[model samples]
Target: MKSRTYTLVIIALAAALTAGCASVAERDSRDPLESMNRAVFSFNEGVDKAVVKPLAKGYKTALPRLVQNGIRNVFSNLDDATEFANNLLQFKIQAASSDLMRVAVNSSFGFMGLFDIATEMRLQKHNEDFGQTLGRWGFANGPYLVLPIFGPSSFRDGLGLAVDSHFTDPVYQIKDVASRNDALGLQLIGQRADKMDALAALEEAALDKYEFTRDFYLDRRAGLVYDGRPPASE
Candidate 1:
């Protein structure tokens, strides 16, 4: 069943890419599915307003700073493995080594990542994902996409998310299914809570929220791919 879902997601991403290419010369050239994307974005916004925002607010209010930091640290530590793998794939030996060491330090001295001792030890963290891996391999960032619940993405990053979820996410590797799901949920909620302030500011400042979101996400992804200095063409 999981394999089937992965295959379907890949097929859909391919179709979206082809459609994006076919319409690149006209309209919202970089986002050929603007109409559909706007609709999805609206739905996502509604869901966020109805459920996510309230939950994030409550989570922020209920959790103490120390606990929240610990939660964030744990999730970040788990993500280090994914970063290590992507760094290796991108031929970033130094970054891969740093990520591996961070993971080891956090898992041992930090008590399964309840704290981030690696950062204090002067070990820098690197942001590496499958999307950046693809970019390093010369894959084009396809059209912008608005995923259900997930909000803004691009064809390339969307596929990268799928790959990470299905393969690299350590939360899913837990033997106890219920515990894994709980951990994943907590990670999502913690992230949402962490971003609440920034998101509120963005909502207040943006004239066209959709366009602002799309542009910001694209810019951020570009920086991530090129390690904070994207090329002029990108």
Candidate 2:
């Protein structure tokens, strides 16, 4: 159920990215790839105006309690493993080691579901997401790609999606066809839901929404590669 919802959410989001940039493409006559990029941004803008913003608002209006947040934490724990792996691959030894400890302790305590018990065990969750992993591996931000329906992403980050799907995902382990897909999709949507509200707030007051989004995406990608610790000055 949750997974299926999440799948649609992914589709919807991909469309959003593409569509959001489409309008910009129309105004600026660029090369073939740039035109495509614009179209994606156009589509994402529309989805934001329509679906993404509303879903985010609805979620925020009804806050979860400690118990529910705990459960959400548990489910999110499964993802920490992959994040750990990616961090190691990207050369963030300290954070990667921390995630490994998290997975070990959580799995031992049956908190593999990430039930916040891991925190009590002193296993902190180091924030990790896929796009950042790609940047560290020498992939240039190919182009600012507004993925139609997917919302904001660059060509580089877009490829990151495939990396995450292939390596980080544990969905393949789910036995039941319906349940597995449902769970996977739900997770994706849930994460998206968490971000939508913040994004909406930021976008609402931006001067040049497109440029703002473009710069924002790049800045975030760079920040992630360096694990929020800015590089040392020369």
| Candidate lDDT values, in order | 0.83, 0.62
TM-score, model 1 to reference: 0.90
Residue pairs with clashing backbones, model 1? none
Model 2, span 62-95: residue lDDT tens: 6565544654675667777777878887788988
Q: Which one is best on lDDT? A: 1
TM-score of each: 0.90, 0.69
Worst ten-residue run, lDDT, model 2? 25-34
Cα lDDT, model 2, residue 206: 42
For candidate 2, the TM-score is: 0.69
Give model 1's clash tally.
0
